[model samples]
Target: MFVTDNFHSLKQKILFFILLSPLLLSAQAFRSYSNEFLTIGVDAAGLGMSKSVVATTNDVNSIYWNPAGLVGIEDYQGSLMHASYFAGIANYNHASFAMPIDKESAVGVSIIRFGVDDILNTTELIDSDGNIDYNRIQLFSSVDYAFNFAYARNLIFKDVKFGVNAKIVRRIIGDFASSYGFGFDAGIQFERNSWKFGLMARDITTTFNSWAINEDEFNKIKDAIPGENQDLPETTEITKPKLQLGVAKSWRIGRMFNLLSEANANMRFTKTNDIFSSDVVSIDPAMGFQLDYDELVFLRAGVGNFQYITEFDNSKSLSMQPNFGVGFKYNGIKIDYALTNIGSVGNALYSNIFSITIDYSFFRP
Candidate 1:
């Protein structure tokens, strides 16, 4: 009798695995977009310009862009942002804090979360009595989280700054599986003759994630489906290194108006849909501009994600993403809003992003 019961339990588990095969394949396989949540970016101000602020970024958001910019913090700064994607089905949130340790060094920490909550679990829909039961259905969530620790210092060379970031990545799949990953990033910024140049290397050491699967939970839904392989899924994921180079300059339009312009090139070793694609490396270029009046009110615009879209008839066309934003600052508090559109031409979704930043120079400690 024990042997017979064990066989039945095994059958159920197989059926469950078959249902979630698509998810398993995407998560376990090596891909260009591994740890893609990190690439989505943070802060309304940055996103408003389509993430083209790497050369000019110098606030709490710099923890994710180019940490070297953190040295721009005078005393202490904190930032928070929230946005919804995919028609409110998924949520992205971020928070960060930065402070200067002395006159030339600074430290910062940031957190990010992207998740899809309250998903239905139907593994237990069928009871042992051979009856269909809706009561057995459960709800669960799949979430990804990242923690960043950063440090920046002024290089001995004049007008140069250097920085690095240590990152911890965590992913959870409704208690059935989880992964932990570690990675590092390095960046440098140099200013000469009113021109700011920056370089950032993400996942410089090649980030890796090791997954742990719950055996007991995995076994609960045995071969509920026939003619399906029940082998355990892959246990490892890898994210290769990427490079970003940027240049920016700022000019005073008048006594009360200032304008800043920036351009960036993102390089990936693997061939991709970017405008410039090659087997050795692919480069995506972006540009943005910001106009501020009396350092209080601001307007921002940017274009990026240049790609060649292939049509049904095998023809290709160029496509790009556009972003817009506005900002207001008063009494050390700044509020920013951005309307960002993603996807190829004729098939795009818009998401609204909001962020707030506070700076306090009163506390020296």
Candidate 2:
């Protein structure tokens, strides 16, 4: 009787977990509608500086962060970055190339890919002999990719620049579902002496994701999992617009050291029915500092994504993410490394990123 009772308790727990899984998944899906992989900072330098690059970027990697900074690139530049995220469970990769079209204009192209590999597919249904079948299990992967083409030009004013990015996005889940999206971004920057300011409008026209699902394939797998049979959606997901504003100041310390500080605010506006919340607006702020030695070594640190949570009607708490990085430069090549702390969303996770860049200038006779 005790054994039978224990079995019943175990079954109850299993059923409860199965029932709760969908709710958790639904929340994640809703968040991803507008907060996809592209929003994640790419290069190690940007991530290392806690994504405070809006006003301090001046390389090919700026194609992903703030395109207006492309005007600061005086030569042809190329960058590549790779991140081992979530303790090897996933990978993020980015590459970009930028070149000057004239004294007043520059153009760049970049690509990003984030994905997980070799995820096992399992079913709850038992085999004929009442034993689990391991040999018949399948494996799959999920991936997200984005391609961006960007252009930047100095306005009639020498210290002001304007830029735009046109991008295509794709998401795929094994062989069951896929989504395609297109979006554009615009930005402006103003610089004078050691001070710089920037403004970026993300998804200025709003981004729309159209999903194409293989219902038959999904249903087959769903039938094997208890309480998992649900119809797939045949609709579109739209992402609203957001604005980013930033300012930075730089100072030369002595003859061999330089100090730079930056602050940024991201403002998100959404309707009552949007995925974020009923609140019409929200703001997230970040700040960082960089110390450079003789233009060869750099140290960076920052904090961002402050959140306030209330529990039990009496408990209130705050959370913040911290990041740090180091880099080295020689000749025209630069290498950077960064570590980012991601709070306990899915296990206590941290991301490590590495990136390299090369620059070359053509001399005009």
Candidate 3:
């Protein structure tokens, strides 16, 4: 849903047809939650939240965000993210690990958890007692393991890397609801000189095979609609994929400074299916600066199509219209963090990401 460039008059027409071809096929939009509240980028600790810059494999976390980045992983790398939000009522945590399996192969795993506290459980429709029981909370967890099986002697004298992953997801909702699903993701990454480009396609095949509902709640709803078929409205199965494209460039500005710029676009490719509904192809443009001292530090800022979800809002002030983050590097290890404000859907959004990276150098053959 964006515009790029054209080589010639005939090239423009050909490019238009190839890009719009996906609309001819079926589509599914929301692969995750309706809000897609999983933050805009990678771990909050890294500058990725402000930009889509995973093509170069700067760290281990990129494997989960873009498997193609795994081709750049050297030796072993790992990272962890922990964040608090909504006045400390919610928490997000994650850890990712990637290791070189061989000269041209690498594998990685990631675990992420989201928790909401002090959720008042109610029996009747409305709150009868002013003080509801605050004895429990809600929890959501997902674990993804990806193996980067990459091999490329050279493509026309250029290095090319391809990767794919199999992911499993699980969620629990305060004993009231729970669902688990299996999905797959694939990507290609390339890095040459100061330029990096990557493409990632997710949810090629996904199935939320099981959903458990509370027995008492199911009976209540069934009784409310006496003569009707009363099948649960949330039991529909979905199978669709989301494709994203990203590119980045980093320039050595001076002896003690570096400037990096990146751009990304995400879209839902179906035109006729309800699953392909809510198409909002958003582009995130970001700029980052690295202060090269004895210890490396990074500063970044950017903006995108993030507005509001259902839990929190910030429409008053700057309105979550911009994204910002910082990073720190020691030796070969790095850490990143980011924050965004979305105040439209009654929810506030926040994420904290941390990652560690190890570097290995290979002389040009």
Candidate 4:
């Protein structure tokens, strides 16, 4: 009983700081490398495929995963993925390619884009029957882009590798505003025979400062409004700083069968502008598995904690446990699928994310 009480108390203290840190940091505001959305933070290739790091093969997406995964690879690889977010209301797409310039060096290019679609613009905030509100009016639709360039090399030490990513990012919110920022990612991987250990630091300097739009800047909007005093949105920019650590391993159990296990944790920090008063953090831990029934079929199942997190005790449940997926491969073609949910406290259908991604790659000498 005493232990339970102390645990609960500690949880409250952490939650209070997280909710208050945003105000504390700026006394004021922040999103991560890609956006506030973690679903699209890393490339879609890994999202619909597997979060397994230790056993993952060399691929262009490694720029966001664990770049050290490229250590033993000697190939030119690329993959394209499309995730239909929120039942096709929004589209998430990614493309990436990597080339081994030589045995000791590799370079890669990666891009992630999300299109927000079909938003209706109107004066009413809700749907109207006789005089009821419909929904909020959206003045414009926008898409976000995060471009990545990476370089990885085998370290002088045995079975160790390192890499870095330079990110180019931007976000357009309606026609009224947009923001720009840049960030970097670093990673290291260690491998000894079949088992590997990996770690990644994402969005080290990721931040977006909203641009001030004066009358002289946006002439079109100024001309239309004439003398109307239009109030702009918040003055502080929203930033998401990535702080994540993950470890994964695989055991080649038997011929035609492999059993793999993975565990990962990520905490996103939301800091206030120029205040440096600490920040908001969300910590998530996940455990999962992969099974290879044959050379042509693969299956995966994972469960993680978004609810029982230490600092997120009072938070809403964005992801429920038990996320399961499957995949198939033939020749050089591959297909994959996974299911994830984003439900508010009691709403079951709030967010149903079904993703399907394909990959076509052949070993290159």
Estimated TM-score for each candidate: 0.91, 0.84, 0.67, 0.69
Residues 1-365 of candidate 1 have per-residue lDDT tens digits of: 56545655664665465435534664565666678889888888888888898889998889999999999998889999999878888799999999999999999999999988987776676577655578988888788899999999999999999999999999888867789999999999999987999999999998888888887666565345555546667788889899999999999897999999999999999999899999999999999899999989999999998999899999999988999999999888999999886322336688899999999874334
Per lDDT, what order, best first?
1, 2, 4, 3
Off by over 4 Å in 2: 1-35, 123-132, 223-229, 270-278, 311-314, 342-347, 362-365
lDDT scores for all predictions? Answer: 0.86, 0.76, 0.51, 0.55
What value does the lDDT take at residue 321 in candidate 3?
43
| Every model: Cα RMSD to truth | 4.2, 4.9, 14.8, 11.8
Query: Which candidate, 2 or 3, would have the higher lDDT against the true structure?
Result: 2
Q: How far is candidate 1 from the true structure (C-alpha RMSD, Å)?
A: 4.2
lDDT of 2 by residue, 98-125 (tens): 9999888899999998888886654332
On TM-score, the stronger of 1 and 4 is 1
**Candidate 4 residue-wise lDDT, 1-365, digit = tens:** 56644544454344333322332233114433235443443432244333545335456668667666654445666666666656677777777777786787788888888767654433233233323344444445556778888888988998778888787766554543455657777888777776666777776665555543333323323222234423333445545556556666778767888877777665656432211223566565666677877657777777653452223566532434455667676655556566544311222332223333233336322
Candidate 3 residue-wise lDDT at 343: 22
| Model with the higher TM-score, candidate 2 or 3 | 2
Off by over 4 Å in 4: 1-34, 38-45, 48-57, 122-139, 212-230, 234-240, 269-282, 308-319, 342-365
TM-score of 3: 0.67
TM-score of 2: 0.84
Worst 10 residues of 1 by lDDT: 14-23
Which order, best to worst by TM-score? Answer: 1, 2, 4, 3
Off by over 4 Å in 1: 1-23, 219-229, 342-346, 362-365
